[model samples]
Target: MQHDFLKNYKHKTKESRRLYSRAVKVFPGGVSHNIRYFEPYPFFVSGAKGKQLSDVDGNKYTDYWMGHWALILGHSPKVVVNALAEQAKNGILYGTVNGVSVELAETIKKLMPRAEMMRFSSTGSEATMYAIRLARARTGRRIVAKAIGGWHGFNTALMQTVNYPFEEEEGLGLVQDEGQFVESIPFNNLDASLKVLETVKDDLACIIIEPVLGGAGCVPPIDGYLQGLEEFAKKNGSLFILDEIVTGFRLSLHGAASIYGLEPDLFTLGKIAGGGMPIGILCGDKDIMSLADPVARADKESLCAIGGGTFSANPMTMTAGLLTLNFLKENKQQVYSKIDRLGRMARKGLTKLFAESGIPCQVTGEGSMFLTHFSKNVVMDATDIANSNRELLKAYHLALMANHGIFFLPTKMAALSFAHEEGDIKKLLEATKKIIIDSKLFKRFA
Candidate 1:
């Protein structure tokens, strides 16, 4: 059955097969990013619009991956595209400070007031890397703590214990001493996490974590888990940082901090903030953020020394981000209400469907994102996620793509965009039901 599905995928994506053949000659694993390459090669996208992705082979699938969960308004919303076209006519990169960048910053500050000051970077990795640096500088401490399965980005310093088998070395090329000052704690287990923090409390610089764990699994933190960590950091004289790159604007306009009542000393934002363009923002209190002020410090020794790259705050990104935020701000009620409602429907429908078929599974996520864990046990952390039936989940996602026109990035989390509606959810449910009935793979899971 697995072989049959692979054959079906190959038959549908012949052009993609040819393109991937050429890609491997230049790129590692036939792709720039590791996740983009999956079993039997990934389909090359020709274009995308709204909630649909059209591949080079003319196969269209309702895009649940949603540009790594960045496109909340969906592919090419006219509001952003039209304004971006005009902005492009003026300039894309000035390589210097611009007014539009200031406007965008002001807009973000107005929306999320905790961001008294901010600096823009081209990627979330840069934002998170800088966040830790600022914490170390502020407290004059050395150690940083992160959740076991939390993924901040590819930054070398925070790369410890990101994948499964949390105790093992992440991979080659990372120096042994690089992770010396970093500590990992289990997610959702506040007592165990606090015990680990106690060991390095004196030298702890910061506690950086994702409010909702992405990449590792779409697991939401249990109640009071985040708040307890924050309280510990506060008492231990360490800065508390929230890596909201995935949960920032997606959960709500105010970000997850507001929803969870967290007052982090420093926080990072990316993904949806970019508005389908590339952007990364590090926001914090005025006093802490001012450490990066070159003019105020006057010397390299006195400053934190963090800023954006050449592409940071380019006019194109600033324009698109500003437009997207503006649209969301104006229609905030409509946008959040619709997307959250859809998220509830997806979770509930899937839970009931799986139960009826005698399949043991748990659907995990908050707001508009979700993932299925093929396990009877409750999933609360990365260890539980690692123990789940990942192979079966991958096969299920593959079947959805090959036999049905639904798209999920294999076993990764799926996010519903504002462009998706009730009809789209119905279609997805229908497809899942058909796959459950027709595929012989479900028998083993049952």
Candidate 2:
């Protein structure tokens, strides 16, 4: 069955195969980002509009991956494209301070007041790296505690335990000592996490975490879990940093921090905040954020040393982001209501469908993000996800792409944007049913 699907995928993606053949010569694995590569070569997208991606092969797909789950308004929303087109006429990158950047920041602050003071950067990795650095600088401590499978990004300092086989090093080129100052805690297990935090409390600079475990799995926090960590960090004199790069504007207009009632000393924002453009925002309390202020510090040692890169606050991103935020702000009730409804529909529908077919699986998610784990056991953490039938899940996602026109970036969570509708969710459920009935892939796990 897998062979048949692979053949079908290969048949449809011949042009993509040719392009990937050339891409391998230029890129490390014929793809820029690692996850973009899949079991068979990934189909190269030619264009995207609304909830669909048009591939080079002339095949169209309902793109649930949604630009790494960024495009909350979906691809090329006319409002953003129109603004960007005019902004492009003016300039793409200013390499200096600009008014649009200030408006964008003000817009963010208006929506998320916790962004009392913020700095723009080119990527979420930089924002998170700077976040921890600011924590250490502020508290005069070296230790950073993150959940065992919490993915903060590829930055060196926080690259402690991102993947399964949590004890092993992430990869070569990252030294062991680089992670000596970092500690791993169990997510959703407050008591155990607190026990881990107790040992390093004295020297702990911060406890950085994602409200919803994004990349490790779409595992939402159990009750009191996040609050417990926040209290611990506060009492231990450690900064509680929320890495909301994936959750910031995606989860809510204010962010997951607001949803959880968290007062993070520092938090990182990306994805939907950028409105499909490249951006990362480090935002927090003004007193703590002031550590990175260059004018006030006046000396290198006094400053925390974080800044927006060359492309940071570029006019294009600023324009798109500002417009997107404004759109969301004006129509937030409608936007979130629709997407969240669709998300719940997908989760409930999929769970029921799998159960009716005698397939034991668990769907984990919150709001508009979700991932399916082929396990009868309750999936509460990354270890549970790792133990689940991942190959089957991957095959299911692959079959969706090959036999159906739905795209999931194989094995990654799916996000419903404002562009996604009830019809799209119905389509997804129907296609999933067809795949399960046609392929009988779930029987292996059953």
Candidate 3:
């Protein structure tokens, strides 16, 4: 059978293809970010409104990627946009401490009671990097333990065993032996994690984990997994740092820390916390965060030396975040209710469609984040996902985008926003059914 999906995609996205031809001359892989690049080329989005994206080719898609899972309220949310606009008129950057920054921090503290003190950074990577440094400085240890597939950031220190094969190192230009400072343990496996922690107990500075394995397919931790990890970390004299970059506001206003009743020693947040702007935050107990304070510094050697960038807590991001947080705080029940319903709808619909079509697959996730795997077994961890048929999964994802106009991350992870309604969920399910039948994936699996 002819692959009409690929043909239709190429024809519909002719303009994006032409642009990619020019972009390749400037960018390494014709894309600024690696994830944005796929087999044929990604569609250049002209604009976005709510949960819909209009590509340059005038093809409108129900955007499940949602700005890399940051736009919980959907793209260009009116509240955030209006706040940003008002802030821009006053001034964009002040290069000094501002009132809005304090307000934003206060809002975070109110939402996350454990955030006694907080410091701002420019990106999620910087927040995680600083959190790791603080843990090392406070504990006077050299090693950090992370889950096998957890993606903290691009920082070299936490770059080992992320998304790549578990046996091989994922760091590219990391300093020699830097990977040794970081150890990987199986996620959601208390016994395996404890074993690794026992081995690295002496040198372990921190155990950083994402409550839900965001990039590895939104796999939630087993019942007491997070709490167990925290206990193990404490027992080993290591701090627990929760990376809530993707789940901060997307999962709950207070993040996974609140949902799981986890009291991490340090928390790194970004994504929705930025209100669609570039921002990162590291918040924790006052004593731990004080190590980064210039005024509290006893001496140069005593401080952790966490640096801030030029636009670390600019007014624009502060205003936008403040508005976003306030909106979430006021309309918590309504927003979360809609997103949770949408998530259940999508998962149930996909599972039924795939099963009826005789395709062996499993949908794994919690709340608003989910991903489809081409396997019948339950996905408990990253290894389970890595063992599946990745090529076929990628083909299915491509088919969804090409033929059905349902955009998802090429890794198959998807999310729902408050903007998604019952009708949108129905549309997505119908499109998915059509794609499965048209792509003939069921025949291959059968």
Candidate 4:
């Protein structure tokens, strides 16, 4: 079955293979982004609309990746696209302040009361980096505490313990001793998290975490885990930073912080907030955010120096974001309920399918995001995921893409957008069932 699937994949994606052959000479690993690369070669997407992605090879897939989990409203929503088109005619970038940026900021503030003051950056990584810098500057500390397997961004301070084995450094050219400044605590383990925070309390500036572990398989925190972390941070004289890059708008209109009743000292947001454009936002209390205020600072060195990129808060992204947020605000109840229902349906259906096939599986996550684990043990943290049958999970992901026409992050997580419907969910379940039966996956697991 595996061999046959490979043959079919190769035949269907011959054009993609040809493109990759050219791409390899230009980009490392034949892909601009590492995650886009997969075994054999990843198909080149020609277009995306609603929940469907059309590949260059003429195969259409039900896309669950959703622009790396950024497009909650799905691709090319009319409002966002129209706003972008209009904004493009006026100007893309002014290299100065704009009304659209102010409008977007006001909208975000209305939704997130904790964001008393906010600033923009070009990408999630920059937002997280600025948040860390602000925390350090405000608290007069250098150390940060992060959850084990939590992914904040690619920034040096928060890059440790992300998908890599605990205590193992994951990237190259990291600033020396930067890893020392980051202490990892087991996610959802209140006692262990407290102990780690206490150990580094003296120098700990903040505890940064994702309310729902994003790239580490959508593991939501155990009940009260976020609240406990916030309390611990305050008790230890450290700030609490919520990295809502993935959960800010996708989880709810107000974000995970609001849903969980978490009042972090700082919050980093990206993804869906940009309305499918490149954006990052850092928002927090006025006292903490004042460090980034250029007018208040007498000199450049006096403030934290949260520099902006040339493209940060450009008119195009601002317009798109404003339109997206306005739509979400207007239809909050309907949008949230539909996506939540879809997510629940996917989880329940997938769980039943796996069980009926005699496969050891666990479905985890909340709201519109989820992940599949090829394991019997309950997954509460990253280590549990690391210990699962990863090869089997990879095989399953490949099978889904090659045979089932479903596309998500390779064996990582799946997201449901407002564009996903009952029909799409039904197709996913049916395809999964067919894969389980035809690939003999049930027998192998048994």
Best by lDDT: 1
Instruction: Tell me the lDDT of model 2 at 364.
Output: 89
Model 4, span 1-446: residue lDDT tens: 35566677888999999999999999999987778888778899999999989999999888999998988899999999987888788888899999889999989999999989899988999999999899999889999888889887777778888875777768678775878888999999999888778888999999889999888878998888999999988887889999999998888888898889999989999988899999999999999899888888969787888856999998888888889899999989989999999999999999999988778889998999988898889999999999888777777777788887888767778888889999988988898888887875556675
Q: What clash pairs does model 3 have?
A: none
Task: Give the TM-score of each candidate.
Answer: 0.99, 0.99, 0.97, 0.98
Candidate 3 residue spans exceeding 4 A from truth: none
State the displacement of the C-alpha of residue 370, model 4, in Å, after optimal TM-score superposition.
Answer: 0.9
Per-model tally of clashing residue pairs: 0, 0, 0, 0
For model 1, the stretches where C-alpha displacement exceeds 4 angstroms are: none
lDDT of 3 by residue, 153-211 (tens): 78878888887677676646667588889888999999988988898899999999999
Model 1 lDDT on a 0 to 1 scale: 0.93
Q: Residue 77 of model 1: what lDDT?
A: 97
Worst 10 residues of 4 by lDDT: 1-10
